[model samples]
Structure formats: structure tokens, C-alpha cells
Target chain A: MPPLKSAATPVASVLAADARHTVTVVLNGTPRTGQAHPRLLLSDFLRHELGAHGTRVGCEHGVCGACTVRIDGVAQRACLTLAVQADGRRIDTVEGLSQSNQGPTEGRMTALQEAFRRHHALQCGFCTAGILMSLSDYLGRNPKPTEEELRDMLSGHLCRCTGYAGIVRAVMDVTGQAAACDTRSGEAAHV
Target chain B: MKPASFDYLRPATVADALAALAAGGDDARVIAGGQSLMPMLNMRLVQPRLLIDLSRLEELRTLKADSGWLSVGAAVTQAELLSRPTLRDEVPLLAAALPWVGHFQTRNRGTVCGSVAHADPSAEMPLCLVATGGAVVLRNAKRRRTVAAADFFVGPLTTVKAADEIVESVRFPLAAAGSGHAFREVSMRHGDFAITACAATVDGTQASLAVGGVADRPTLRSWPLVGGALLSDLDAALNAFAWDLGGDDDQHATARYRRDLVRRIGRTVLEEALSCRR
Candidate 1:
């Protein structure tokens, strides 16, 4: 019989969730392939395996929408999706949004991000990335959304910092429902 | 919490899936949308030797309507199902109930059949199916069968499905014309699970009631919409319900509170539905 593992012996990490499968996903605009465990979450794969830290993981149970990402043009909870399930799919994360929008280096953030900054929609900003990704995708689908529809869409995300008033105003301003500030700063609007 | 190790097998067809499931037997689990299962797995609540991913089974994703029933495939995502305009027009109650099932993210990948199979007491789909008098179609390597939604849910997170069986689809009977329905739930937050919910359908002079989040599963009952008695004496109507509802007290609310809310919310929903009587 094998000797009992000493109290100090660190247990060998719970068998690694069977990492014998290959997953290939087109993340953002680039294609990425990796060997991942069947049980590994897509959020962890993006953050750990691919070093895409912009995709946050919160309430991995799918309640808090901080881990929201776009899979095949649909906003989805990354925490609940397995990396293996994302095989052969297209994924869009907050990092990709940032890269595509040409933030700061181009002397410009995406109109939505700029709106968030201007309207004081973000406080600590922990929930900013996920919220931005969700709204960006939602707006792409619906360029003009009513207040009730916007509230319903915003209900999916939980933001502890901003009470979401400014976020609402920012989206409205971007959609041109209200008077927006200068587009040069990309920062325009108030709740 | 991370999930325990398990082999993932993606089968191309329902037959292949059945074969894989039969081979894996007790060690296998079917994963469609992974909304419910993934959360359970992350919490380490269950660990299986092999997971038969049913994502590739195109046969299980078709949405079709027949003369008697509207069929929703096992792998059809809740969001996808909600997007179908015909479904919205034909099953208004389902359309009203879908938005309350989960937030946009979860619904994007959550499946109606997965929800039926998970059989969560507070989940919206099973309760909707049960109230709408729907049925669940199940299959195994040997045969296929159907079970009424009311009978399909054995208990919380429990069902009658055998280890080797699969939930093929759910068939909800098309609502008869001139039916007005309403759904409401009391949750701590907008997207959180319901503390208590009420769904009511007004079909002619008949009213069907279903109260969820107050028991191990949604409690259903029906009454004649006679002379506005149900509307006027709502509390008595609720009390009169054969609430064979097995309720318990937990962090959210007490059984007594649930019973009270059932009356209040049930009344509100019934009133709302009947007010907009088709």
C-alpha cells in the first residue's frame, strides 16, 4: 500500500480535468489553437493560456456578468463556457475591443469607452471591461434602443461602482438620442 | 471552483450520441448548453468519467411547429428560441416567461431542454412547460418516449431520466387563440433566481395558475374564471388551491412567507392576465 500523504504534502492538483483535447478558436480577429482540459473554462483559457487578462472572471457561476464575452456575435458568459466547447468558434473579448478601437495610442478610445470615461460611468472599473464588451455587441445589433430595452439589457451586468445612470446616458449619447459632447474627445454625455 | 477531469466526446448525431451514452453508461453525462451543468461542475457537485457533448447533434436543434404542439429541440438555446417570431406570436406566455429565465448572457447558451433536464425548482422553462401542459421527449439507444412536464420533474435537480437516456426535445402545445398570459417573479435582484414567482393564463373562462420558487417545483392549478370570483376573492382562491406544494424555509424566505406571497403574486398575475383578456 502507498504510504499516506503527509499533512504537509501538497496534493497533486486534482488531476487537471483531462487535458487531452485540442481547441481552436478565432479570438478577436486572430486564430488561436491550444490543448486544454475538457473542464477548463473558456475564461481561464483566455486569461491563462492565451494571456488575455482583459477578460475578467467574476461569479464564475454566471450570475455576475463581469466575464461576459462575445461568441459568434452573441453576448455570452465566458465563465460558464468550457474552452473545449469554444472549439471552432469565434470569440470576442474586451481586449479585442480595445485593440480594434485603437485606444489612447491612436489618441482615441472607442466611442463607448470614451462615453464611459466622460459620463463617470466607471468608478473602480473592475466591471468596465465586461460591461463595455456586452454593450458594444448589443449596440452593434441594436443601434437605437429604447430606455426599457436598454435597462433590460443592462440588467444582465452588475456594476457596484457606477449606479448605471451614467452608462445609460453614455449609450444614449452615443446613439445620438441626446446631445453628445465633441466626437474628437469621444467623451460626451450626461445622465 | 474548477471542474473535475473528464473526457469530452462530441457525437455528430442523436444515434451516435445514444451509442456513446450507452457505452459510457453510469459514467457519462450529456452537456448541451452547459449553463446549468457547468455551474454544477465548477462547484464540484458532480464528477463524471466521460461527458458526451451534444452540441454537434444538429438533429436536436431544430425548432418546428405541428398541428398540436410546438417542438423545441434539446440543444436549442433559450435566446435562439426566443428570437423566433412565430414562437413569440404562437406562444405569448413562453415569450413573456423567457426573459425572466436568466440574463442575456446565460440565455445565450442556456437551452430549454437543458433547463427541463436540470429541473431547477425556480427555473422558468420547466415551470412554463408544466403550466402550459407541455411534454418532454426522451430517448435512449433502445427507444424513445414522452413524459408530461408535470411528471418529468421528480424533485429539485432531479428527473426520471435514466442514466443512459437523453432529453431529445420538449413539445409545448400551441396556445389556443384568445389566450392572455402574464408572468411575474420576486427576486432579490433583477437577474437573480426568483424568491417567488407567479404565471397565469386566461383561456376563455378558464384560468391556469402556476406558482414557482415556493416549492421544490412549480405548483400548478386551474379554475374557472367564473363571475370574477378568482379576481375578487384572490386570497381565498389561492387558499383554495390544492397547493400540494412542498415548501421549505431557507435564506430567501420562509414557507409561511412563500405561502403568503403565492397568494399576493398569484392574485397580481391573474389580475394582470385577465385584465388583458384576449
Candidate 2:
């Protein structure tokens, strides 16, 4: 084992602890600017500073997927990201999903969202925004994913209600796969 | 949970980052992907006086395979590594273990070297590193050094890394011809930390098994099959190794159950590796 060095050497200047930095990001197809303390998370920055409430914050840690959003077109946890880290980046939240390329129609829901409504994928709706953001990004890349792959992707999120069966059906329907639903029995169909 | 106030710096180059570390010493912390560190920060587990962000440093994003090793740079995310076309061929153990590191959402942001820097007991990255006989590159303002993965981790969430140093990259030995590797873990949830993880690498002459989440650090034991060993001897060696790991009863599993996993999953991975060998 190499000898562990102690922290005795001294060198240069550091930013003040209370200093706030100006962060600018292209959020939801618009340039948004805000001032944030270095300690502020991107989740809070989006919700409080930028007024993008579609990106919810849950489990301030990375466990719950409610804070998941698209950074540079890739889905990632906003809670795990710092506001300054997302400076000068493009961020797409659930609000932007409705505005995506859906044949030139404004405020039109994506196929995934329509399926979610048809299959009753959301209840209480606390985790819906994050799940929609993740799935919308995912189903775009992997348009036709196996049930196992979709389930593996869904494992990242935690939803108290719905038991994830409706979410599975919704995704299956959007991907052009036949999904059986038994609403009368209130039982989850085999995914 | 919210993180305590701290000064944040995004250095454009590694030199500036090292300078910031040298100045702040232990009070400054380097953050790459922040998958593990952010949770700690939000929970106030680690509140540094300064936070240095390395996401913008382009030089630290190298991921290349050469010289019989797949060298992953500090800024290489787990998703980036998994997306590498040659990852499965160059480093099969890592390719097998990367999916189990975190969920797809977190993996999109979690760096490969960041996991090694965190050095969690049940983390799949360190276990794969030790199992494949890899190395970790450490850099500071003044010097650079390489340490074997087996010697890099001393305990859970603890490594030989110094306060003024950063993990420059990690090098995983490429899979040799006629060699095969496999990884398996038993976690409470799909994206949760493993209760017990097993990784195995085998070739014509030697068979090695590494187990994590059951000890202070990932431990590896090898058996030589040059002339061929008896089945009973192999079983006895595995059983002894499982006991030696000293599984602790935790919220997720009992000590006995962990040991059982070590013995069972350990053998299952070894058998899978042996059968996959070309």
C-alpha cells in the first residue's frame, strides 16, 4: 500500500462559501437564468428559481426518480446534480415532453402519456413527471423494448401506488406491443 | 435533506483542479458524477468547505483499450462505458458488473472511476477491479501513482486515496484468450446495494473468485487447476473462504444468509465462468 498523504500543504484561493453564482441553462426550449448558492441542487433550482414545477423533487437523494430530468438529451437524476453543474446545458423536463415533435400540434401528449392515461398508470401522481421524463427519453431510443428491459428501466423509480402494472401496460401499448389489462378483477396482467 | 453550504469550483483543466485540492487540502472535495457523493452531501454525511466539479475537464474523459488493458478515465460515466462497442470483448467482468452498479437513470450520470473512488463495500466496480487484477491511478498536484485494486481499498467507503489526490483513472486488465468472467449479486432491490456480490474469472490454469458486501472489502481467493484438483478440496476451499469473509448481520440480510450466498453464488459464478471459457 502506498503511504497516505496528510493534508498539511497549503496553496491558493477558494470562492466564498456564501457567494451565489449566475447559472444559465436552456430549459424546456427556452433560456432560463437564475442565481443559486453553490449548495443548491438542480432539482430545487428548476422548481423554485426557474419555475419548472414539472421536475419534482423527492427523496432529495437519488433513490426516488421523481427528480429525474433530461440533461443534454439524456435522462438523469436532477437531485444528484448541482445547479452550477447544469450551467450552460440543455435540460428537458416533463413539460417539454408535451411540446415534442408530435406532428406540429401544440400541447399534444406523446403516445406514452396517452397510454398512461388510457391504462391508468398514475395515482396520486407524485412520481408521474419523473417517470414520464425517463420513459419518454427511453422509449425514443429503444422504441420497441422487451418487457424485461422496460421493467429494468422502471426499477430506477419508486411509486407508492399503481404497483407498476399499469405503467408497464402503458409503455407496452406505446411501443406497439399487445398488453392485456383486467380492470374488472383489479389484478395485474402478466407483463 | 439539503447539503450544507460550500464553495463550488468547476475547473477547466486537471491542473487547476489539482491546484484547488492542494489549496483546500481536506476541506475541498472533487465531484465527478455525484451519484454517491450527492446523497452523502444532501444527507450532510460529508460537508466540505469547497466542492470541485470535474465534469468539464475534457482531458479526463478518456476511455480507450490498449496494451492489454481497458483504461477508463475519471469522467467516463457508467453509461458511456457500457455503450462502448468493444467493452464486452475487452473487459468482460466490468461489462457484466456495470449494469448492477445503479439504475439506468443514475448510470447515465455515474462515472466508472467515481464508483471506485467511493469504494462502497458492496459496490460492483471495486469488486470487478479486484477480481480482474486491475489498477487505480492516483494523481495530485505534484505526482502520480498506480495501486493495485486489491491494495487500493482498505475498508468500506475507505481507500488509500489522499485528501489532496484524485483518482485519475482505472485500468482493467483485458480478457485474455481462453479466459472468461461472470458477475452476480443479491441486492434487496434491483437498483439497491448488494447484500453479497460474487465475481469470477477463470482460464485454463487458474480459477479466481472474488466476493464483496460480505467483508470489509472485496476479497479474492484463487485455486490452481494446473494438474486438476479434487472436487472435495475445491468445495472445502470455497467454504473456508466464505467463513473467512465474516459476514455481518445487517438490515438487509442475516450473517448466515450472507455466508450462504457467498458459498452458493460464489460457486455459481465460478461454474458459469468456467463453462464460458473459450
What are the TM-scores, per candidate, against the unseen true structure? Answer: 0.90, 0.94
DockQ of each: 0.31, 0.44
Give the interface-residue alpha carbon RMSD of model 1: 8.1
Error of 1 at B84 (Å): 1.3
Error of 2 at B106 (Å): 0.6
Candidate 1 per-residue lDDT, tens place, B79-130, comes to 8888898876677789988988888778888999999999889989988888
Whole-model lDDT per candidate: 0.81, 0.88
Lowest summed lDDT window (length 10), candidate 2 chain B:
B225-234
Q: How far off is residue B29 in model 2, in Å?
A: 0.4
The docking category that best describes candidate 1 is acceptable
- Structure candidate 2, residue pairs in collision: none
Worst 10 residues of 2 chain A by lDDT: A1-10
Candidate 1 true-interface contact recovery: 0.59
Q: Top lDDT: which candidate number? A: 2
Q: Model 2: residues >4 Å from true position, as ranges?
A: A1-15, A101-104, A179-191, B226-231
